[model samples]
Target: MVNTRTTDYWSQFIVDYSGGGDFFIANAYGKSAAQLSYDRVLFGSALQVVENIKLINNIIVVDLPVSAFQGLSLSPDDRAFYQVIADNQHLTGYEDLSSAFRPKKRIRRVDGPYEAEYFDGVYSAEKVRFIKLSRKLIEGELQVGVVVYLAQTLQSRNEMAHDISVKALQLVSVIFTIALSVCYVFIWFIVRPIRRLNTVLSERAPTDLTPIDTDAPKEISELLRTINHFMMQLQNTLDRLKHFTSETAHQVRTPLAGILAQSQNALMENDKPKRHSQITQVIDSCESLSRTVDQLLNQALLAHRFKSKALEKVWLGALIKEVSRDQVLTALQQKVELAYIGPNDDCQIVGDTVALKKMLQNIIENAIKYSPKQGVVEITLIIEKNREINDIRPRYGHS
Candidate 1:
């Protein structure tokens, strides 16, 4: 059997067979009237010439079927035909979509994925398949707008899906950003107050039992309670330390003083050089022991005053003068010269008067002890003017 391709039946037969309208032909072959008629009806559409053109391949080509051209001249049917094609959401089968298909047959279903070219919009899953087939069966290549034509009725649906996706993404992004901001603020509120409390705890306050502003960020209430608990422990430790030092000093100082006095008296009574040397060594040992006890007592007193914050304000000048006066007699006994060089008038400083007196007396007594016979010990008090008054404890060092 001879295979005929692309029909070209005569006009008179085209008019008779096609209800007397326009015609189009498929390219490349001549066939008997009987054969073309069988081919056309079998193909499900009639073939007639709408345009007759010569092909470089030495073939005459006429495109589409007679019915298509017949409807093209009828303006009302033209739009309806296009509309029907667009609404006809039917797949052209997988065989047409397959890359290898190159059929000599031209009349096939123009409903598939290829219709995207006619309508440049997104398509429904069913509609997308229809346009895909249309391009393979009719236009012979996949086209951009062809898919659009098949799926155009479903354009609103595609747009709605797209908008929903974008809106959902935006909502997620906004929610995350809001959550992050809230978390940042929450943490800052918790940390800032706790940090302030930490600063206060580290500093040397006047007392062990002194109450601090316990208010803090509410988020970490447990952490604040822990710090308060630690503070209580610290106060207990300080109290124990102060009591121990005071008790130890009292216990050891009285006996040491008695021993020092007895040693001094024995040193004077001993006439033998060897005996005098032994007595002097004993006196030195007693003196050293007394000094150590005095130091411990003084430190314990200072700690106690710090705990109570009972350090009273006194005239620094009167304080200095009293220490100087006491030192004069000691200086005279030691055969050392004592002098003062500072402000003429009273200078006020906030501190415990007793502790201040003791401190000043200790310094002067030390000066008298260390200075050579007939040496001058100068005591100076410098007053700095400032709004906030503080105790200027003078530290003496030998250069």
Candidate 2:
């Protein structure tokens, strides 16, 4: 009985040891399975976080595992693959699962505080801006891992800016066109009166010195008045010249005829005394002709001097005496006694000397010519209370 009991106890102890060994092995296997399940759950959570970020922000996210870098998690998009480079500057893994995007140079590992970089390049034959981000994970052994974020191209933004510029240019062109049109109209109205004035002047004859008759603005009207005044002065000058020409011709013809007739009469006379008388008459006629020519020349000279010379201080009494002395010969030939009766004191006046002398000479010559034989022609200078007056009178002798 004792041997049987010992056998039973030993069998029982062996069975317990086997069962405990099996339990220890099964517990270790279950703990390993639970840890694997936890890792999968955590990895799934990380992928979900990455997907949520991509959905909210509209960007691509790539999460790479350092231990098994080939088993990386990527947000769902049209992009085909992504290249993962290690901090050692070596390409570690790539997502070759999809055939959507063509192979291109993607994100590079960055070492500084900034995690992103921007570059410009051609993508699918269109200009685009490429934005890349590389982030180092700092939790656990995953610190060796990197997270990449990418943004879409900036083609749309550039197109929007171009549209705005085109609209601004169009608006400026419209404003410039309006300003040009307004200026053209304003200038046309301003020059209308000038064009009419030019036309009127062009159509008139060269000899026509008549005043212009046209409606115009105040400024143009003032100009027209000035032009009319000039025309009137020109017309007066032309009329005076015409009259002077006719008078000169008549005066010259009369003296020449008288000289010719007297010369012929002197030649035909038979008696010596009568011939001598005729010759004397011819000499007188010649002298009269010379005097007439000289008077004409002096008149012309006086007219010119009156326009050109300024007034001067003249001694009126002295000028009168000098003119009287010059005409003494003519007075004797005409059988007239010329006398100057006035105050001996000389009188002063503001006048042109040539003009005053000519006036006095004309008065004395007229008085002497019209006087009867042996008549007295007196040039009297009279001083009144307010002014000086010169009196030329002819006194005839009774028969």
Candidate 3:
């Protein structure tokens, strides 16, 4: 038996006597091989195997011609490695030895960073060689076989390593597949939520400019915020345009009605004295239409000027008073009152002065037209925490 810490040399001795294990019940004898005084026992099975086995220098040796080796080409280095194996005696020293084999100090291989395997097993192709013993049973019942030690080589070890590497790579392939599955599922978790968020944003209600609650995953929040800001501006611009259009419609339609009325009345009159008055009425109606069109044009032009953003500091009270005074003649003709209610003291404000002047003209003219004769049109200015529109009211339309 081979001990856990020691391979039995007695195991080799048993081969010289033609046996596998050192112990056996003798078929018809007084003792077993285990009880024998010598390490080896001569058996009837030995004679049958004796001729088939080869021994040289008391070292057992064997050579096998393999069909697989015959078909392959050998490198010069590998050829040299095989020659060293055939010439090596240390591996075959057991064949000629008369005395029982002794346990050897293990040999270390200098060239191998690779693993070395020793085979003392029965019928191992690379290590032990077995042969038939006379094709016959021996000692009335014992079956016999030949055993020998073969040479070792770097080439042989290389072949085994290649096979083992292939098996290891196959195991790694399985692990790689499992890892890919995990990654695919993780990415799916990420894309699914993003797709859902995209659907929600694109499908938003048309009437609702309310900011979308994207619940964005840290990554897209800044984009969502920008989208929301744009939506707010768009909503505000649309509202302003709607109100402007309604006001413009009202302003334009009134003059058109007056012109229609004047023309009809003039057409009905035959006297030259009455004809002159009707023509004057038509002329006045045309003037009102012209002023409304001019104001609208000025508003458009001023809006273009505002884009330059050259808002300079100008005196607010003076700016308003200048525009109102210029239009006082028109106000008087309409039998409406015009006045500045603000502090006559200088109050400087930051704005485009030209645009502000135009704004005041439009506002003041609106007040004069809507107010009754002797109505008080007061423009009050306050220099306070901020510019307060409440401090002044054009009593014409907004009573």
Candidate 4:
């Protein structure tokens, strides 16, 4: 019965023996036959272990001092073989089966005392990793030792890794395709509302300024609201322009008709003084027509200013005085006295100057038109605390 300590010692001894064999092979390089012979003799005691194993029918029999070799207990597929050669000639070696062996590729030379190769075994017809240690011993003399291992586990691991890589690649491709499809759907939903808006605007008539009615996302809805506001403003401007055109035509027609009638009357009058009075009436009508035309033009200009011009600081008192001065000639022609009553201090307001001037002119002109002959048309600018008021009135003048 071999003890545990004895089994361990023999196991270590086997490992040391294998390593020593590689060392011996490498050191044997560049040695003549006589030198090799002499070295082997010197190492005869260490080499005796291998010879003794051979004498025991390649089996390690342990009773008290020896332990059975553990390799003999391994399955045939896991078993390893060892061999030795000298001068490219077989020296001493053994295999379970008779077969030819040749090294197919040099694998690597380990940093230790050994080299290794890989090959296929003709007897088993299987791939194997063959570890070797070799040396050139003098001219035409070489010696080597090799240990061969079956590569079944390595081949199985390689196949498994290839399968895993293929599966991972397939999973990645599937995920990318699904993500692309989702993005395409999302973009389509976003673009659909914009396309609808385009179609509605493109197909409408040029004169159409009606608000658009459509359902959309919140952002697009805000854009639609802005567009609708612009359209409403455009519609109001068009309506105002139409009304102004109609009013201008009516106003002009009245003055023209009056002038024509007065001229015809003057042509028929036999009295010179009466005919001269009729001619004066025609001239007054023409002047009134001219004033009306000017007012219409001013109104049009004010409309444009309202759209395009921003409010500015205006001197209200000065503007009122200027308007009154401009209307003095018209008031005199009508035999109406124009008077301005206001504080001398300048009053300021934020307003459009053109619009304010036109408004004041309209008030004064209307006052003078309605006043009787020898009437006074008074324009007063009253400055109160925190407010300013413009007043226009007509009063009868003393004869």
Question: How would the candidate models be sorted by TM-score, starting from the highest?
Answer: 4, 2, 3, 1
Per-residue lDDT for 191 in model 2? 84
Query: What are the lDDT figures for the candidates, one per model?
Result: 0.50, 0.61, 0.52, 0.61
After TM-score superposition, the amount by which residue 129's alpha carbon in candidate 3 deviates from its true location, in angstroms, is 27
lDDT per residue, candidate 1, 199-301, as tens digits?
8777846585554666765665777777667778788877788788678867787767767776766767656876677577677777777777787778778
**1 or 3, greater by TM-score:** 3
Candidate 4, after superposition: displacement of residue 77 in Å? 30
Best by TM-score: 4
Clash list (residue pairs), candidate 3:
58-94, 58-95, 58-96, 58-97, 59-93, 59-94, 59-95, 59-96, 60-94, 60-95
Please tell me which model should have the higher lDDT, number 3 or number 4. Answer: 4
TM-score of 2: 0.43
Off by over 4 Å in 2: 1-192, 261-277, 298-315, 321-348, 364-380, 388-399
Candidate 3 deviates by what RMSD? 20.4
TM-score of 3: 0.38
Q: For model 4, how many clashes? A: 0
Cand. 4 Cα-lDDT: 0.61
- Which runs of model 4 end up more than 4 angstroms from their true locations? 1-185, 258-278, 328-341, 366-379, 388-399
Better of 2 and 3 by TM-score: 2
Q: How many residue pairs clash in each candidate?
A: 35, 0, 10, 0
